[model samples]
Target: MPAAALKPKPLPTQSTAKRPVQLDLPYAPVAKRPLPAGRPREWYVTHNRRLKAMRLAIALLDSGVYVPNQARNETIRSTARRIGVHPPSDTTCHMVRALMRYTR
Candidate 1:
């Protein structure tokens, strides 16, 4: 290919158009589905722990704590509290950091 053909074109400028804000369905109540019956006790524990870790990780990210280092155990616990969740255990906090690390 020719040198000019190989040259990248300049990118277009971003639009400043305002978009409609999406609102949560607070008034539309959704029923919570219970966990499946007959699962092993260990399975339930692991499942709940994973859910807690995911919630903490999402809350941390939303609050501008992207890096795992910034999400210490105390910070994770505080986020959980703010989000109306029980304070995460040490293992859950570690899992939250791991989620953040791998996702990033």
Candidate 2:
């Protein structure tokens, strides 16, 4: 058989990203946001609300699949990305970690 005839057809292009077969990384980087001091109570409250929304979204992710299997950190990151922000507050991550721990 000729080599050219034996070659397989090229595959179609993909719109969705392919999951990597493997990943290597050191510890995940902590996300930090510095809110200015001397702000009003309303600012604080709104900040809390936004962070709570983020937490709720994470909690709701994968229909509440247990954290470790849900790839919780990545899930949180993508949720934040979709909202066009990093994790809103230090407490947000801390709260998520605590919730995951309690759930497990």
Candidate 3:
């Protein structure tokens, strides 16, 4: 095969980055989310409460104690405990449970 038919020519090699880079999720530009017009990169921090909150939500639904979208506060709190989520307080658990109910 002629050179033209050989493997496509490679692009000129550029300097390799010296440092390994890490990427963030749920962010738009640098991490694929919309970034500021001009400034340093911004990383969105993930909260652990949301994790347990979501876990509580899913577990309750999975256990059939709470429907995908029709659970009440008591149902969520019970499910949260069963799933090992530490509810900060009765009130907060109440709130997250109610919120989880509506979000379903």
Candidate 4:
């Protein structure tokens, strides 16, 4: 077979028409309220297990009725479970500590 025969034929082109482009009208800006200081917007937006644990911890601390038992890990796990969050782990404890630090 010849090289010319092996080459593919060019595709046919359709006629192009010029049409008017419509631009969207700009709307007026609305005033927005600012988020509270020291707390992150992500904390409210994302409901991750760790954040839930942290929120629970903060609420317990603020209530002034939460007392730690001999087993700290057990207490954390029980509190998390009561609040419908994931079982407490090292990461959850770390998140609670970080949240405590920020609030202080």
Best by TM-score: 1
**Per-residue C-alpha lDDT of model 1 across residues 1-104, encoded as one tens digit per residue:** 79999989764434532554455665864798999999999999999999889988988999999999999999998889899999888989999999999997
Clashing pairs in 4: none
What does candidate 4's lDDT look like per residue over 1-103, in tens digits? 9999999976433433245445467688679666556767677554465556566676557645244332256666666676677676676665665565565
The CA lDDT of each predicted structure is 0.89, 0.60, 0.57, 0.60
1-104 in candidate 2: lDDT tens per residue? 89999999664434433643343565886898788899998999877755665464554454554564454565665666765665545556555555555665
Model 4 reaches what TM-score against the true structure?
Answer: 0.39
TM-score rank, highest first?
Answer: 1, 4, 3, 2
Off by over 4 Å in 4: 1-50, 62-71
Better of 1 and 4 by lDDT: 1
TM-score of 3: 0.38
Residue-wise lDDT of candidate 3 within 1-104, one digit each (tens)? 78788878564433443554444465563454553454533222224455456667667656765543455666666666777766445554555566566875
lDDT of 3: 0.57
Model 1 steric clash pairs: none
